[model samples]
Every structure is written in C-alpha cells, then in structure tokens.
Target: MLENLKKEFLQPLEEFTPIPFWFWNDYLTEEELDRQMLAFKEKGVDGFVIHPRLGLPEEIGYLTDTYFHYVRYAVKRASQLHMKVVLYDEAMYPSGSCHGQVVRENPAFASRGLRMSARESAEEGELLIAAVKREGKTWYFWEGPSGGTIRGVHYGEDDGEAGAPASADLMNPEAVALFLQLTHERYYQELKEYFGNTIIGIFTDEPNILGRCSKEGMIAWSGNFLEDFYRQGGNEQDLYLLFADTDSSEGRRAGERYKRAVYERMSRAYYRQIADWCAAHGVAMTGHPEKSTDIGYLQHFTIPCQDIVWRYVAPEEEKAITGEHSTMGKCSSDSARHRGKRRNGNECFGCCGAPEDPYRFTMEDMKWYLDWLFVRGVNMIFPHAFYYSLRDRRKEERPPEVGMHSSFWEDYHIASDYIKRMCGLLTDSVNQAKAAVLCRSEKLSWEIAKPLFENQIEFNYLEEELLPSCRIENGCVLIRQQRYPVVITDGKDTPETRDFLRRLEESGGTVLVWNAALTAQKIREAVKPAETFLPPARDLRCTCLRKEGTEFLFLVNEGENSVTTNLRLEDGHICQIWDAWNGTIKQLELPVQEMKLSLGQRESLILVTDRGE
Candidate 1:
C-alpha cells in the first residue's frame, strides 16, 4: 500500500489538477482563449470553471447563441488539451438570476421578503401576510401572503450592491425551475456531448432567496413558504414571534423553527432539484451556498464545496481557527465523507490579501491557503480564478488576480504540482477520526473545535439531524464507513439530540458538552488524539487517514512559530516521510514508539506508515 501510494504521489493524475475559475471578463476571442488555456496547461492546471464576470460584452449576451459559441469553443479546446471543464451556472452570481433574466422575464418571480409595518401607516400596495396582537397593539406583517417574517428594516433593491444583478426567489420552486430552463438546460442543449466527459459539472455560485441588498430586516420568502411552514408543523402565531425582539423562550423557538423551515424549503426547491438534474445528465452539481455553515444544503451537491474568499480566513490569525467561516473546510469535506462522496472542494484565495494592498497576493499566501484546506480533508482545489483579461477596469472588479498575470505565474507549476499531489493523497483515503462534534445545519461549534485542533484531536462535524440514522455500537457511533468513539456538542441540544446522547452515553460512548471551562486537557481525557505530540505543540495541526492499511498523517504548522515535537507512533509501524512539494519519499529509521519531527513556520509534512516493520 505504501509503495502504491508513493507511485501515485509521484505521478498524480490530471483529475487532481487545480481547477481554477477562468474569468471570461472581456470580449473573448478564440485565439486568445486558446493561448491562455495553453499557458494554464503548461503550468499543470488541467481544468477550469468558465466563469462569466462583470465586464462581459453586452453584445455577446449571457445564455445567447454568441455566448454558447464561445463556451462551446472553450469546451472543445479543453477536450483537445486532455483537460476538464466545470460550467459556471451564472453570468455573474449569486447564481439563480441567470444574469437577471429570471426576474426580468417574470417580474412576479422577483425576490420577496416580509416587512413589519404599523397597521395605520402601512403602504397602500402592501399585502398583509399576517396580523398579530401583542401588548394591546396590532402589528401588521406585509409583503404578500407567502412572505416569511423576520426582524429588521431596510430592504435593498438588488441582491448585492445597488446596481448588482437582481436575484431570483430561490425558495420558490417555480422560479428555480425557470432559472434552470434559462441556464442549466440551455447549457445542456448546447453542450450535451460534453456532459460528464470534458464538462465534469456545473458550478452554482452562492444563491440567496432574498437579494443580498434586500431591505435590512427582510427575511427570505417565496409564494409557497407559508404553506410549507404550516406543513412542517410550524404555528402561524410563531411567525409573529420570529419578528419579536424578545429574548423569551417562545421567540427563540419560533426563530429556530422559521429558519429550519426556510432552509428545508430552499434545499428542496433549489439545490436538490439541481442535483437531480445533474444526476440525470451524468454530471455533478458543485459550488457552495450563501453561508459557510449551510451544511444541510451541502448534502445535495455531488462535489460538496465551500468558499474561503474575502479574507474570511488568513494565516496565523484567530479567524483561521474560530468563527463560522473557519468551519467551512470541514463543512464540505465532512459532509462528503459521511455521504460517501470521494471528493470535496474549496473555492479559495479570492481577495484573501490585505485590504489596504489587495494586489500584494504572493506565492507564500497561496501555499498557506492550500495547506490550510488540504489538512482539513478537502480533496478538490478550485483556485479562485485565472483571468481572461485584465484590461481597463476589469482588473479592479475583483482585485489581485491569482493566476496568469500574478507575480508567481512563472513558478506556478510548483504550487500546481503541490496541489495535485496533496489532493491525490487526500482523495480516496478514509479519514481516521475518533470524535464527532455535533453541529446544526446553519451553526457549528467552533469553540469546541478550537481546543480539539490545538490538542491534535482530529474530529469531523456531525450534523445533529443525522444522529437518528447513526448506529450506536460498543462505545462507538457508526455512520457509513466511519466510526466515532466520542461525541461533543456546544450544549445547545435539541430534545431529539439530547435523547440520542442519552442513548449513546448509556451504550458506553462518551458525550461532552462544550462550555467556557472546557479545555484541551478535558478534551484529551474524553477523546483519543489521532497523533500524540511530545510537549504538546498547540500550533501543529494533524489529519490522519487510512488508505489500504497504511496510515497517512498530514501535519501542518498553521502558526507563525516553528514547532519541534516528537511523534509517538504505535509499535511495529514502518514510517516514511513524503515531501509533497518535490515528490520525494525518504525512509525514517527511528525507535518503534517515537520519531523526531520539526516543522518551520507555515510548513507541512506528511508521514506515511504501515504496521509490521
């Protein structure tokens, strides 16, 4: 198994190549496209997502014959280059608008939201969604009958910036179906021959039901949301409670119910429908949703993904280890793991540089992000983008192009080779984790995760909803092909989850509730660390995986300081170090129980071992 791994590592397949989003932000010509693609090929990039961006010429027109002609040419060129293509579903995103065509063609399909207004001062055209009397005052919630209620005021006209493309109502299945007709179906009609072949999948950028620029207090809503909410056992009165600013238990419960209903409806109406379409067409539904913690919607993606753009995470920063976006890497990877999917992706490195100097993105910054994702079990790489043109204001649209025109373009193959090699190793291996951290669809317990990471206690985020289907065995929770000896939570447990934990604890499995006093010592006592480090290196992160009886341990120094530690390996294990950057394997002759290890700041190492030395 070790020999096979070494061979595969040395010659990682093209499928593992970093697939960048190729921004077609200009009046593209076939000759220029061919030249740029050849340049990418030379740098070990074998795949690209053809992303149409802000500067695309109006004459070409999104989803028009002129656009199809260019898309077809690119797909054909990729095929000739023995490369792969991922079709970007939107002309610009958040994806569902199809470049504003959906809302423009059917104004009723425009994004909607609920707003609270005084009964006497309500606008003339306002359709009352619901009415509730509280404190001797009658509150009117208006935005048509189906609009969902939430607390906030200040509805913006479009999804993103003021002039950004209008977004479609994702909670409405009819609108989503129309979006597919205008986008996905149109692509299929033009490129049917490339589906599942040269064209591997469709990339749906973050889709939000309420336009990003919607009124400040507006909650995502659609025509059928009320009916769906009712069908899901939600009370009509609770809708009013959702808009209440009270910290009462009823208000909290109402908010939770409303959010869950919205998530479920949108997941069914949008993501699942797209997944089904991709399945039938022999392709994959890739890309992410609006929020990083939207794990529930990830189940519908064939190559479940999350984005790490906009400086959400940076090297040596607290943001890298805590917060909601920090959980994104595991959000996609763990979802794919539990679902039996072999690969998961991250659309990384967009605007990750310092805000003051956005163009200062460097090779070091790029490698840091790659290591961060790879160590988290992510196997697919979608480098934020390679630009088709940087002419005029195109370069300013999303500053700091990471490919083709970057300072490191001449030496890019080094990063490309590193990406392919790491992705190759992570792809088919089974993650060896002993603990599961319980999380919700839209929430993750990053506080619990922080101590675990610092302690080298590898864990996967287990969605609380999946608890009932998991099997509790002899001191272990079994789900699909993975097993966890202990489960931890943030103390925010539902009745069902509480009952499940009770059953698990009764079966000799460990269960922990996260709190202010929870420490690394406490976690180490409850869960066995995947790899033990002498002197306890807090900045050293480790991910262990098993591939055909051999353990592959990827260790990353995510901090600024160098880490010197001794690894305690099991007896009878034969150890070897694989340098991913240079594709070199070296045998290490060490004591059966211990091996010396040293990692520089921001450096990573891979240790492959098998029993019976």
Candidate 2:
C-alpha cells in the first residue's frame, strides 16, 4: 500500500494553495479586516500566516501593552471564524528587531539601517522615524504604514549600524536570544494570557544570526565568532566590516562559515527556543530561514524546526542549504524554481514553486524529483508563495499570487485545489520512504548534485524532473522506497559515497555514481572500485535480488529517450510482475527478455523481476 501510494505522492498536492504568508493588518480597519478575511475564507485557504505588516506602521514596535490589544482583537476575529492564523511578529518581513526608519532613515543613517537599499532610500528620501531609548540605548523603527515607496533596495545596513539595513540583527546572541523570549512571553503577555481566545502562533521570518540591532549609529560589532574568529583567523574585524559579500578568500571562508553557523545557531535559538515558548503559551511558529539555502544547517538549527523549507538564490558557491555533515542510509531530494536564474518578487518571488503557467520542468520533471525526495523523508509542501491572482504579469510586487492573474474568486478556487492536492500527497509522505538516492563521496558529486539538489520543495532539495517518481520522508530529501540499480547521483567520494558503493560491493546492491569520479588511474588503482555487488546479468539494469522469499530486479534505463524494458525471472519468464511506474499490469506470451516501451526523459523504471505465479 505504501509503495503504491508513494508513486503518486506529490502529484496530488503539487499545486500552490497559500504561500507561507498573508495580508491584513493595522492599515486595514476592523471592517476591512472582516472583508479581507471573509473574502479569503470563502476562497478556501488552509490558513493564514498572519503578521502586523510593515504597512500597518502604528500597530507594532516592541510589543508594548497596547500592541497586544489590536493583536488580541485580530486574533479573536481570526480565531472566531476558525482561521489558521500564524502571527509574524510586530513588524512585517523585517521582523520587529530590525534597523530601518524605526531609528533614523537619514541617507547617512540609511546605510546603517538593516536591509535598506542606499539608492532606493536616497531617492525616496528620509522615512518616518520612531526610535525608543531603553536603558541608554536608542532602538529604532518605522512600522508606519505601507511597503512605502521602494521597489528594489541595495546596500543594507552592516555599516555604522546594528548588523542591518532594515532587518533585525541576529549576530548579537543576546539580542537574538532575547527577541525570541519576548515575542512569546513579554511582548505578547496579554495575548498569552488570553491564549486560545486569540492568536494561534508567531511566524518568525528570516531571522539569521545578526550583529547589532540597536537602531543607533553605535553598536559593538563583535559577533558570536568575532573574538575566536579574530584569534585564529586574521583580520576577524574586517570580516564583519563587509557591507556586501566580497569574494576574497578571507571574506569567502569567513563569510561562508559565518553564514553557515549563523543559520544553524539561529534555527536552534529561534525555532526551537521560540517554538517551545509559544507552545507553552499556546502559539505555533513557522517560516522560511533567513539563509534560505543551507538545508541541513536549518534542519538542525531551529526549535520546532520549520516543517517547511524555502529555496532561494545566492552565490554559485552556495546551494542555499547543505546538510551539516552527511548522513546517508538513504534520503530524498526536491527542487524549486530555477536557482541562480533570476530574482524578482520578495520571499515569494520566483522562489515560489515553478511558474504555474506552462509549468517549467513539465510532468516528467515532477516525477523525477518526487521519487528522489520520497527517500529522504521531507513531506511538507511550503511552496515559495501564492500570487494573489492568476493573470500574473512579469516582475510584480510583494504578493506573487502563486502565478495567477484572475480575481480572488477564480484564483482562490485554483489555489485551494492546488494546495489540497499537494497537501494530500505531502500528508502521507511525512512517514514513509519509497526508494533511495545514492550519495557519492567521490566528492566531485555536484555535477550530478546540481541536477538533483540544486532546488527544493520543502526545506529538502530534489530535482523537479525527479519528484514525480519519489515520496517525501518526513520533510527532507527524496526516496525511492524500493531501491533501484544504477542509482544516479552527483559524484563525491565522501564516506556517503563509500557506503552506497560498499553496499553493492561488499554485499550486492547497486548505485550509479555519475561521472564515476574515478579517473583511469583511480579506477585502475582501486582495482574493482573497492566495493561488492550482487552478481547477476551484467546487462540492461544492474542488480537483481532474492531475499527471504521475495525476488526483484532493480532496473535502470539511463537513456535520454525511451528504452525497452526487460526482466528475466524463474517462473517461465513471468510475462508481467507489476508495473510500479504507472501501477499497470502487463502479460507477455513469448519469452521476451525485454519489454518495449518509450522511456520518459531522465526516467527510472523498476519492474518486478519475479512473481509467485
């Protein structure tokens, strides 16, 4: 049953329902809120990842006593109607602890603001400011109203400011740690008291490990690793001084590790910490990582750990997210939009799922990835976003609308259905594995890796061409559920590579490491690739197995075009076993060692080599 279901897993819920976000805030009056909620509610959304939007300026800042009132009111309304409401802190995307106008939006100070673009801000001029001085410190803010006159931004704050542009500073461990504490406890005191009466949980946006979040021009730049980094590493201070990513060897190594460590640490600090706190006070936490790449970094970092992972772009040297070390028994891989392609929208940009239009990679692309991730255990479908419409034009604003351009009613219908389909597959995916992907420590595996791990579905990365045939394990990587010979993979000869190769060598299983990583010397030097394989026919698909009373052939059709399928078995060349691919059954009269069928692109088909008949 699990095997059969795994085949069609992602197919069901592979559409965009609602991205991990929403709209409706202080700007929208109580009446407006009612109308928006009612409109969306009728549209059949799973829930809303609510926030006090940047557009709702007067609504947030420090989560004071009064802030809770509006929140409570909103929560009550949302809850009364049984809406899934996720509270995204006081501010909008920047989170509440950022450095924008809340402090000083002056062009000079703007550079100091977190995430603020120098060119954009200067053009727009100074923004409304409202800084708070707590214990001899000037904390800034500009939670005024609206996305407020800015298209693209550049030069975020990392200069004379608190590790910022217009976003929160996460490097200052204390600030980060404290911010987590307050959101669940201090900030939402009244709400926490009211609990189930209002507000479900909080949505913490890309809260990466930051430096200084104080809105003031002065802040200690030392980060979690600054001291030690400065000690063993030369010019540690210079590392922190970079306004943008510099490719210097010093900068690269330092910055990479900084980004990696920050991602991991913050996940633990915020996801786990804040999640636990929210749970205690009756709130749930969910959002993508600030460092959208680094999958494993995120997996081990956050508290509750966002069941949903996001895929975005960075330098070519980065994969968004890479697992901590490497753990391989077996796992899955997923894909998102084309990484390193283009950047248009916000969090929901192209990073959302594929373009809902022509559907970029195609059905085969979907099957290709599904099968891979099914092995890894990632079952949740938090697509990049749902555009507010179906008639989506190119390069629009924040709300990407899941690639739609139709009105709410029409778009909602399509989105809700899409969400349901994806949710259904992912729901079942949370617990099983259909097959496995091989990880080669050949170390040079990225050639094969890029095709498989370059993009993501949830937090896990899997090539789209591969998703249709796989099942998500628990929310990460791809899985075949049933192993297949010629397991295609990027070639890297790490310990991971050795094991898969060893399984086939020492005992008899099969894994195809692409590019073979071994040069003539390496292949000849190793003399037989240092592993074992179950001996059988050395043609067509590689491995055939008979364990206990079960017998099967792990077939592989690596050809780009269609190839004939074949299976030689004990029972008078069993006409047909069971076609796992499309769940069809076939019977051939004569002794045909090969079954003729057109193989889909990048397709892997495993035929039952034997049967009881």
Candidate 3:
C-alpha cells in the first residue's frame, strides 16, 4: 500500500489540476471558446468555473437566451475536451441577489439593515422605542421625548454605498429561494444532462447580511427580525443595548446572543437550504461565505471551501491582526476533515494586494501563495479569474489576469503540475493531528492559532457545532476516527461549554483555555508567548496524516529563509523523507529517534514511517 501510494503521489494526477474562474462576459464565438478550453486542457488545467462577470455587452445579456446558449455550448465543449465545468451562481457577486433581479421584480425582497438614531420626535409610527444610558442617566424613548428609536429600513441598489445593487436578504427565506430559483435552478433545468457528470458543482460567492459597512455602529436587520428575535428566545428590551455604549456584562451577553441568533438564521436560510437542494439535484454545493474563517459557516457546504485571496494576511504584514496567508485555507480544510468531506477548495488570487493601486502579482508570488495553501491541506484551487476579453476597458475589470495574457502563461504547466503532485499526496489521507483547537471566534482563533502552526504542532479547528458529537476516552477526544489528545479553546466559556470541558477532563483528555478561567481544571494559555525551540528556527509548519497504518508528516517552511532543524520522532519509528519534487524516498541518515534536516525557502517535505516500526 505504501509503495502504491508513493507511485500515485509521484504520478501526474489530472484531477488535482486547478479550476480557474473563467469570466464569460463578451460574446464569445464557439471556435474561440473551444480554443480557450483546449488551451486550458493543454496547459494541464482540468476544469474551470464559468463566472459571468461585468463588461458583458447588453446584447449578450445575463441569464437571457444568448447566455443560456453560451452555457450549453461551453458545457458541451468542456465535455468534448474532458474537462469539468463548475457553474458560478451569479453575474457579479456577493451572490444571492441574482444581480438585483430578485429585488427588481419583488421590491420587498431588498436587503435590509437596522439603524439607531437620536430622534427629537418619532414621526414614523413603526419605529420602536429605545433606551439610552448617557453619563449615568437613563433616558426612555417617546413620540416627543429625548431618546432614540430603532428603525428597520431597506438598503437601495448600492446598499447605501457607491457600487452595484444591493444583495438579496440572506436572512429571509423567500429572498434566498427566489435567488436559487432564478440562478441555480435555471442552470439545472438547462444543463440537466450534465448534472452528475461534467457539471461538478455550483460556486456561490460570499453571501452576507448587512452589506459592507463603513460605520462601526451598523447592525444587520430583516423584515421579520423583531418577530424572529422574539420567537428565537431573544430579549426585546435588550435590543437597544446592542447599539448603545454599555460596559455591562449582561448587555454584552445580550448583544452576542442576538448576533448569534441572526447568524444561525442566515446560515439556515442560505447554507443549509442550498446544501439540501444540491443533494436532491445530484450535484455538489461548493462555494464560500462572507466570513470564511468562521468554520461553523462552512458546515453545510458539500465540498467545503473558503476565499483566501483578497482578504487574507500577506507575508510582509507579520504583525497583522490576522494570521499568515494560509489561515483561511486551513480553516476550510480543517472543517472539511472533521465533517467527513473529502474535498475542500479555495477561491485563490482574487484582488491580492491593496485595493487602491493593486500590484500585478508575479509568477514567483503565485508559487509561494499556492504552496502556502497546499501545505495547509487545501486540495482544490480556483485561480480567481480568467477574463473573457482584455480588449478596451474590459482589461481593468479585476486587473492582473494570471491567465493567457500574463508573462508566465506559456509556462503555467510547471506550476499546475507541481500543485497537482502535492495535492495527490495530501488528499485521500487521514489527518493525524493530536489537538483540536476550538474557534470561539474567527478573530480570537487567528491570534491563538499561530503558535500551534509555527511550531510544527498539528491541530484542527473544531467549530461550535461539532462540540456535541465528539467523544472523549483515554486521554483523547475522538471525532470521526481522528483522536485529538488536547483540546484548546479561546475566549469566555459558557455553562454548556464548561460542561463539555468537564466531560473531556473526566474522560482523561487534556483541556487548555485561553484568557478565561473555567470550573474544569486545565491549562490556561493567556497569551501565545514566544515558543522555545531546540534548533531555534520555528518557521517550518507541519501536518501529520495516515494511510493504511503508515503515517506521514508534511513539513513546509512558511518563511523566505532556509533553516536546518532537528526533528524528533517516536521511539520505535523510522523516518524516510519522501522527496515529492524528485519522486524518491530515502531514509534519514540518523537513528530512528532524531534527525537533522535542511529545508530551503518555501520548501516542503513528506516524511513517511510505519506506525510502530
């Protein structure tokens, strides 16, 4: 089995070839489309997501007769070329709105937001009375009194900003249902023949409530928010405290609870329902949410994915509030592993640098980015964009076309092949992490995760939803066949969370908490202090995976400088370095316990060993 695995890993695995985001805007001829598809095939790309984007001429309108005609031709050509086609579910996105068509028809389905303002007299009869505590004085709202009122209002075409139209109300089921019917179901109806075959999945972009906000005080709201809030056991009186400045603990808890309920409803309406639809239609739902690093939001995805390009921390930004580039990728991959999903993807290389004056990323930068994600267990890649036309003004649509127009277009196969080989080894293997790090929140997890990532300590981020299903025994917590020896959590603990911790402790698993003290006796990691190491260079990140009783350790250097480090293995095991690039396996030239290894800049190594030698 080990020998076969090694051979397979070394071979050119076609399925590992990435799917680039093919932007179909201009009216493309059949010949040109066929030529591009063949070009991708010859360049070692196995698939593409047909993304309808801006700059499309009015004649070739979105979701019209011409559009569906082009779709059929594209899918048919893809079938002939032996490449998969993923359906991008919107024209331009934050998805769910069907490019404002949902609201254009049904004006009531427009996205909504909540605002709290000081009003001398509430002219609108619908406004709810709100309370304000200012300078130790409590003020109550009235029709002509000196307090504030909370109003639920609609966001117009640009979501009250300067851009495209507002998104559909993701928290509202009717709006999301209309979006699916217009976008997803339309594709399904037209491409039924290719459903279970070449049409691999539907890619939905970041669908969120409360459109991008400029002010800190903005809150998400829906038409039925008040009714839903009360129905879901939320306190009506505490709604005012959410928007007000209050340092009280009860107020904070109330606000957190309210936001969580909103998130739950949004997740249900958008993610769960879409997932169920995909399952019934014999296809996979493969896309991402707005807050991609929050692993809980990825639970409903069939293939589980995240976008790592525009928003993730860059290499130069070391002290960034977010972790390194691989942070979001790891979150998606970890969630997939825990949930028994075989594949996880990333929408990579989209709007990489600063929004203003975005830099055109070089081939070298692309390699490092690809390696960062692949090392962290991401198996599938969506290379942000491939423009339909770089002609005229269309060239500046998203800029930085890493496709045919780029300098490295002719040599893209080298990068693609390399990624394919790495992915082949990474997938179909069980992750051998010893710890399950719980993400209390995406921000907190980002701060806490770096220590474990940088020190070659392998762990998976356990989401809030997965806590109940886990079982602990013999100093290990078992979730789906993987055993986590330690469980680390960040932030405040609840009675429910505390109970879970106590149960883990009682079952003999080590529990570690950050910042807060729990009733359960465990290790408290207040801050991620500097880690002390034997050889001293802690830039190499590692992951352990198992296949047929043989264990493998994948170590990758996240830094630009090379470092020689010492690796220690279990007492009874022998380590053999599987040189992935060269496709050769050789034993470490030392005792079975410890070995010194040299790693180059951005280098990765796969070490294989028997379970007990």
lDDT of 2 by residue, 257-291 (tens): 44444344445544566556666676545444443
What RMSD value applies to candidate 1?
A: 3.4
Q: What would the TM-scores of all predictions be?
A: 0.95, 0.51, 0.88
List candidate 2 stretches off by more than 4 Å: 1-20, 57-67, 96-168, 193-200, 208-224, 230-272, 300-408, 430-446, 450-613
**By summed lDDT, which 10 consecutive residues of candidate 1 come out lowest?**
148-157
Q: Is candidate 1 or 3 superior in TM-score? A: 1
Report how far residue 474 has shifted in candidate 3, in Å.
1.5
**Pick by lDDT: 1 or 3, better one:** 1
Candidate 1, residue 214: lDDT: 60
- Each candidate: how many clashes? 10, 148, 1
Q: Give candidate 1 regions above 4 Å deviation.
A: 121-125, 144-163, 570-574, 590-592
Candidate-wise lDDT, in order: 0.83, 0.36, 0.70
Q: What is the lDDT of residue 192 in candidate 3?
A: 96
lDDT of 1 by residue, 40-77 (tens): 99999999999887777777777889888899999999
The sequence of per-residue lDDT tens digits that candidate 3 reaches over residues 1-613 is: 8778767766767888889999775767888888888888888898899987666666776688887898899999898888898998776677787776777778667666555656544433234445565546554433111111111111122334444555666788998899889988888889999997999889877876754432334466676676666665656566667667456986777777776777778887888889888998888999987775666778888888887666364555552225534468778888888889889988887877444556476677676677678777888889977776787766766656778777788988877777787777777888777777776434337656665665556677777667788877886878886787778877466678778888888887777775544421222232121122247555776677777667777777767688788766644455577776555678767536556778887577887765464
How high a TM-score does candidate 3 get?
A: 0.88
